[model samples]
Target: MWLDPFLSELQAGDGLPVLDLGCGAGNNALYLTERGVPVVACDLSEEALKLVSERVPEVRTLVLNLLEPLPFGDGTAPAIVADLSLHYFHWADTERIVAELRRVLKPGGLLLCRVNSIRDTEYGAGQGTELEPGLYESGGRIKRFFERDQTEALFANWTIEALEENVLLRYEKPKRAWMVAARRDWA
Candidate 1:
């Protein structure tokens, strides 16, 4: 998992419940819970949240749409995990969602996320109609692929702890993505 390297640092802070944004089936949520960390798993699908709740009864699940404002208060979350979730949006929506995430995170809190890389051909990078430079619409859904500069621009307001491109084999084919750990430094 992309969060493994940052687990120690995450556990070192106050025991605030981590917000698992776009938590599909609770993969990252389950990982955090196994290590004794509290998690509030949020997703757009009710069925997905149901699966997560069934798998881990202790996890709190909420149905949330990223395009809308998050329900949490400002600076409430100590950390958040958005695994492969932020890519499915237009540029403006992506920016708005990220800003919302920043607004909810505490100062110095971390946002650990993985987004589709421009080189991710196996999972559709340059396919379908191009909505923007790196954003594409295929199969009635939008997906945004980020170059190094794009990721830098996306988290320009935050303190980027780590950003690296990697290939994940969780799917039938290899999926290329950028793993980012950005810290919210200002309120």
Candidate 2:
């Protein structure tokens, strides 16, 4: 989907490793593999991992709990992509996830993060039970929407390379899109 073009920027012949955080059903992971990037597909849902394995037999899949710190060493990967995943954390946990992302990313690595922004259309709102004070529930998951500046502040250390907000017109309804790419300082 929408991440396909963004992922194109990270492909490097057998040299780049990508961590597809919260890789739901492995669609994006599979897509990256087709482009020749090694992808480590990770998510909290066992069922989702099972489906991904069945669909993309070649993909490397891992079960991950976003609430817990990531299981990766420092500078282990060159690029990390998390699509529609960060919103799952409550406002308080945002920093932890950001730090975990930074931890696994190599110096000068690139990170692409897609989350629900506060300006999303009502149609993008969730229907699940709320676990946090302001977050909503959807797909048996908890998520929160962020304003542009709020999201930027979460990854303050990185230099933002690109930022785009898209409003998807799907079936006469709008879907919010918040896409950003930032680089970790090489030092």
Candidate 3:
């Protein structure tokens, strides 16, 4: 998982923040906090923030909608974890969010994420209405699935340390996802 790479690169008193964008239910937040990494966990749900606080009292939790600009100082984040949270956006919104992420992260900082892949037919890959080239609308929710080329194109200027597609089970259903580890190369 990302914990090995993230924890290995961080210590308890590191000044740089480890951002947990869209930290739903505090799964990753608890993991990082338990391992002694200082984390700032943000989510759109107040209930989720409550859960994080209850689960890990030391975590810095906030209610944040990722579609807007992140509420952090520029070049302050040293590492970010965005598990299954980078989807669900139109092209422009996705670009804006990525731009904010790049702006907040320090040079050589990491953005590790898992995103929906186009191959995920077992979940609604081909069933949804195609909104854009890689975007779809299902059950009133919009999600963007990425191919390898799409992933490469989205973060074209970043140092893509790793990008691989795989099928795994989540919440008892098979999920087609892409694991991405990309770094900001310049300040």
Candidate 4:
């Protein structure tokens, strides 16, 4: 889906390391691996990593909890991508995770993030979807929706390259979500 465009922006011979945070099922990992990109796919679920390994053995996967500090050295990766998984963290934890992500990424490296929009219809502002109270279920996991400006403010230091809000349909119903991209400044 959106992965192709994101991948298209990356140069083939960039030779920079890539980390896929919350790489569930590893579909993107498998696709990127086939393109000769070196990717470190990580998730909190061992079972999910195992499944990804069985399906795409070439992808390097490690068990990781995003709430804690990242396992890589500073400026280790040139590109970091977390698709539809960051919302699981509370606002405080989210700040730490973003800081960790910036710490790991090289200067001018890209961070691609996709999160649910607050204007969602089906699972937008409902009681059943919230993990605690304010959050909602964006997909198979619990998430908190955000306005465009809120998302931009989360990474205020970085330069936002693009931001888009779209409705991902489920069984012919529109589900509000957003895809945003930002670049870490040279430090």
Candidate 5:
């Protein structure tokens, strides 16, 4: 998994449970729990959370909607894993959600995430009606792809520890995405 390099930093949260935002099927949550890290797996789908609960009974599960404000307190979460969940929104909504994520994280906390890249042609990069520069709508679903500069602009307020475009082969076809490791440096 891409999270291997950051395990130590992720575990440095003083035993606070990590929030796995948009945790579909709890893949990352399971990985973290298997390594002895406490995790709270959150998703919008109750079925997904149920599957996660069945697979890892020790993991705490919550139903979350990204469009609304997060239920966490300010500077509470030590680490958050967004995975491939931050791309399904309009530009403004995306910004708002990211700001909320930052607000819920402790100073120096990490926000690890992956998002669809502008070059991800195999996964509907330019397949639908363009809502904005990188935002699109197809089959009633909205997706936002990020260019390098766009991703940088999105996280301009935070200290980006790592940012790279990489192809993931976990799926049947190659999936291109931007892997980001950003830190909330201020409270």
Candidate 6:
């Protein structure tokens, strides 16, 4: 997860925890805690939560299904990390989750996320059912790939700090993805 360049601007605080949404494998949780930021890592998979707990006992872990309502109170976090986690929703659910992220963050809070790109041929990107533009239902799972304009429209309400296309070797396979660093500038 890309953290330093974007999150370096924020002032970390005890009242403002960093939420690791869909914190699969706990790598990002480890990253946050190592940086001395308190983190509440959440995921839908019990096994994933278990891994996080085992690896970083200090991180508070929650089993969260992102499609449902989030559990945090308003303005609870100063930073939210959704590494490779926000791309697997239908269009409407995507909007709600984005709004929820905004609602829970303090004004000027940062959100860093990565989603599968339409150019991700390495991960079976273009082989899914067309739910909507750049959204697909592949292998019984809903996956949404993002275009640059689509990403801008999705987070138009926020100050888009950084939005770019990049590729990374995930699980030994090169996966194309979009990285977005945005901030809720106001309530």
Candidate achieving the largest lDDT: 5
lDDT (10s digit) by residue, model 5, range 1-187: 8999999887777999999999998899999999889999999999999999999999999999999999999999999999999999988999999999999999899999999999999999988999999998999998888999999999999999999999999889999999999999975
lDDT of 1: 0.93
TM-score-wise, the better of 1 and 6 is 1
Per-candidate clashes, comma-separated: 0, 2, 0, 0, 0, 0
> lDDT, candidate 6, residue 140?
88
Error of 5 at 167 (Å): 0.6
Whole-model lDDT values for every prediction: 0.93, 0.79, 0.84, 0.79, 0.94, 0.86
Writing each residue's lDDT as its tens digit, candidate 2 over 65-132 gives 97787888998888998988888677778888888788888888888887776666474444456566
Candidate 3 at 118: error in angstroms?
Answer: 0.6
Clash pairs detected, candidate 3 = none
lDDT of 1 by residue, 1-187 (tens): 7788999866765888999999998999999999988899999999999999999999999999998999999999989999999999988889999999999999888999999999999888999999998998899988999999999999999999999999999999999999999999865
Regions of candidate 2 where Cα sits further than 4 Å from its true position:
4-8, 13-16, 123-134, 137-141, 169-172
- lDDT string for model 4 (1-187, tens) is 6667767655442776578899998876787888778788899999999999998887788999998889899887878889878877677778788888889888888888788787864655553456643466556756677778778878898888888997766336777777878888998
Residue 124 lDDT (model 6)? 66
C-alpha positional error of residue 58 in candidate 3 after TM-score superposition, expressed in Å: 1.0
Candidate 1 least-lDDT 10 residues: 8-17
- Stretches off by above 4 angstroms in model 5 are none
lDDT of 4 at 183: 88
Q: Which stretches of candidate 3 lie over 4 Å from their true place?
A: none
Q: lDDT tens digits, residues 48-159, model 6?
A: 9999999999999999999988999888788889999999888899999999999988888889999889998778678867888888787788888899998999999999
Task: Please say which candidate is ahead in lDDT: 3 or 4.
Answer: 3
Query: Could you tell me which residue pairs clash in candidate 6?
Result: none
The TM-score that candidate 5 achieves is 0.98
- Who is ahead in TM-score, 1 or 3? 1
